[model samples]
Target: MSTIVIKRSQAVWQDRTRAYTAWVDGKAVGRLEHGASLSVPVGAGEHEVQMRIDWCTSPALSVSVPVGGTVELECGPNANALLALLYITLWRHRYIWLKPATTE
Candidate 1:
């Protein structure tokens, strides 16, 4: 098996104290709080990763995990506190962002 590490940034003004649900290939594997992280184990191969909070969610991210290796990802609300309302109401799928940490 391989591991996928997902971290959530500390956004004091956005979803400050709640946890985001971590979904791997459509299954809820774990949760991530502001400024926190979680590790999920899965077979080493191609998979989809996403983050959700109620009906808000990040677009699915495609990933490939090498045998017995680990991959790291990071996520946070795509919009700041001021724009959160517009994000969830007008662009739910883009409310949060999930991508490889190296891409940040």
Candidate 2:
């Protein structure tokens, strides 16, 4: 089996108040709190993952994990204030941003 590590940081003070739910292949995996992370074991192959908070969600991300390998993901709020506001009111933009971690 492979592993997937999902993480989120309390980058913005406002975000510190909420924890996001991590999902893999449409199944709820666990909660990711600010500055915290979780690891889930899965069969080696492709999967779809995302994060959600309240009514907001991150775009589904497709990832492939090799046997005994790990895939890392990071979730956070948009940095742009204007876009952040839209994230609250527009479903299209109402999502946290999830991307591959830049560093291990």
Please tell me which predicted candidate would have the highest TM-score against the true structure.
1
The residue-by-residue lDDT of candidate 1 on 27-49, one tens digit each, is 99998988999999999999999
Task: Give the range where candidate 1 is weakest over 10 consecutive residues by summed lDDT.
Answer: 9-18
| RMSD (Cα, Å) of model 2 | 1.8
Tell me, by lDDT, which candidate is best. 1
Error of 2 at 30 (Å): 0.1
- How do the residues 1-104 of candidate 2 rate in per-residue lDDT, one tens digit apiece? 79999888677664777898999999999998888999989999999998888877888999999999999988887635656667776753446888898873
Q: List the global CA lDDT of all models.
A: 0.92, 0.84
After TM-score superposition, the amount by which residue 34's alpha carbon in candidate 2 deviates from its true location, in angstroms, is 0.8
